[model samples]
Target: MLFATEVDAPGVAALERVVLDAERAGYAFVTFPDTPRRPGIEAGVRAAYLARRTTRIGLAPTLHATTTEPFHLATQLASLDHASLGRAGWVVGATTAAEDLATVGRTGAGDGEVADVVEVARRLWDSWEDDAIIRDVATGRFLDPRKVHHVDFEGSGFSVVGPLITPRPPQGQVVVIGSDELTAVLDVALDVALVRATDVAEIATRVAAARAAGAALVFADVPASFDPSLVEGLVDGVHFHGGPPPVITASPHGATLRETLGLPRPLNRFAVTS
Candidate 1:
């Protein structure tokens, strides 16, 4: 299976070293934590910067669903996908604390609101079809207007109209990650489900439930010192909290996040089907 870890810091160089070491150690992805009051660099900004520096590891940053504008988040993520050439994922969460809401000048939101934000993000990602950008300098035409679809999304808390400023991502859609608490929202749309149980039996139960609910991948948040392979069959991957990922060996040949995760490169949603 795949392995991952979380790294957080104020210095870009330190962050880069941790990520690069993780990649060298064979971790499939590196994640950054996000919270309204979190110290250090913003996760999205760090991921974008890391995207330019690393090639194979997935660059995923935590995205708060409640406070951020869905449309902007969608575009930023699409841009990250371009920067990383397909390796992009969003660890999405709803704002829980009142302070976080206050910081964004918004009211607190629940999982339902978070789910809506995610849906809007997905809609916007697909708004600009893959071939929308035709950049045909010879014809003097830049895009096929017909290929861009208006979202016309009206959710309980927000509404968005028209095509996204960004085109569809290389992964077709950037991977959407959600925690176990939001399974109700995630089951229908998320690409990965994250669980925090350390017990093997509990982990297995969570894995079965997530799979039954239609999650394509289930990742257990493992402790730094634990061996991930022991539970490899129970879950699709292990996300460690710190340093050299336990058990999983680094790949000398190098591999992309999709390759390590065993997920195929998704066909563009706008691609013509026979």
Candidate 2:
């Protein structure tokens, strides 16, 4: 398991160096952009670039969720997963601010609704089954039309067209982690479960709940301001930590933010990160 920070904006030059260095050094993942309800387009592009440079690394936002087009988000994830050979995961959240509410031009999607969207996204990932695309230019055939599948997803707050612009992801599932607020629900239905707990007992409780919920993996988020003395007693499988860079954030490596954190790869790869 690799622990990385979720910044509010894209750190292009810094991110480039961080991700490339991590890849070169065998580090697994680097979280680049993490906007609230604004949109992850910029962050997603940067993360994709990181994916393109490395063979085995996962890219995600610490706290990223979009009220943006479901189709667009799914397509982006597919494209990234394809580029990364299925190394994409999303630590998603529900929008709460009124301003964020207006960004999607719809009512807020609470935990349940966001979870439903996640379900839709997962379904969309499977919209076009593997081997669905058979590109044979010689016969004037680019793709086997019959292979495409329209999910026909019609939800209360969102609706999506059938098949995605790309094919299915290699992993068949992207890491989906939730926060402390929705851990219980996410643990039950999500692939990747996350929580911000204060102690070993809390961590154990969350992890157990996540496992009971059938999660693929569980992660914990930590901040830099925490005292190292306080980190002595807690025992957890993994912890995620990050801030900006030395240029913008405090520690050059953000080591002060957290330690003993990991990122899960293929499954949960402990990631050393930016």
Candidate 3:
């Protein structure tokens, strides 16, 4: 996931070039931030464009799930997935600070309600099942009404209606990810896990917990600032090298995320958590 953190429109061109270069360099996805500047300045739409411009590279707004409407968020995310031919992942995070909540007119609501928000987001993702679409012009039938199901989600934090406007995304549903403690939901549901920590032991702990919480992929985080010299030390520091433990995610010093994750060579995928 190459993060496009450019804060201006002009920077988008540079981001697009970088994503194309990364894709050629063996990168898999292009992920950006969801900091919508104003009406018509749609950031997610830009992300979708990035996905559309490149083939085989996934698109995601990793760790930007705090200040947005759940319904709008789901629709746009599904649109991105569909528009991208099923290569979108969403990394959901909470607004831990009061100002972030207030940014969206949310006040006094920053009381660890992230999991609830994540639940609602997932329900919205699953609101519509596959095969819900029917382009039948013969009988003026367009949808299998039964295939579209209401989410009927009423979490303490919020609720979402069923049947997203777009058909169920080709990826079935966009990958719903939660960083850190957001992985403790008893149901233990998520397609991917990212362990953003400087310490191998700490990340290993998180990977184990996430696996127990039921995750498919866990990517260890090693920031770009990680010294290349330290790679040897970190490799030696991998908790379970010879034998596989329940879960051990190790982030080694490298220039790109693929290097850190032992995925040959490629572009980066970190927002710096060290």
Q: What is the C-alpha lDDT of each candidate?
A: 0.78, 0.56, 0.54
lDDT by residue for model 2 over 1-274, one digit each (tens)?
2333454435567666666555444333455544445454566777677676766546765333445567777778777777776677666656667776676575565555666677777778777666666788789787777666777888656678677777777765565656645546432255555566657567667667666666655655555443323433332323345654221211122111111123232311111110
Candidate 3 residue 99 Cα shift, in angstroms, is 1.6
* Ranked by TM-score, top first: 1, 2, 3
User: Which has the greatest lDDT?
Assistant: 1
Model 3 steric clash pairs: 29-58, 151-162
Worst 10 residues of 1 by lDDT: 250-259
Q: Each candidate: RMSD to true structure?
A: 2.4, 7.9, 10.3
lDDT of 1 by residue, 1-274 (tens): 6777888755898889888888777777888889977776778999999997987888889988877888889988889988898888898867678988888886666546777888888878887777788998999999988788887988767799958888888877888877765775433466788888789888888888888777789999877887776796788778887554454585442344555566676664444431
Candidate 2 Cα misplacement greater than 4 A, ranges: 1-10, 24-26, 36-41, 62-66, 183-188, 224-237, 244-274
Which has the better TM-score: candidate 1, or candidate 3?
Answer: 1
Writing each residue's lDDT as its tens digit, candidate 3 over 1-274 gives 2221112234678767766655554444444544423334356766776866877555666444567767777788878777777766676755546766666776655344555566666556666555556889998998867666677766657776665677766665576644545676434355555555767577667777877786655555455444323334322121111111122122222332222223332111110110
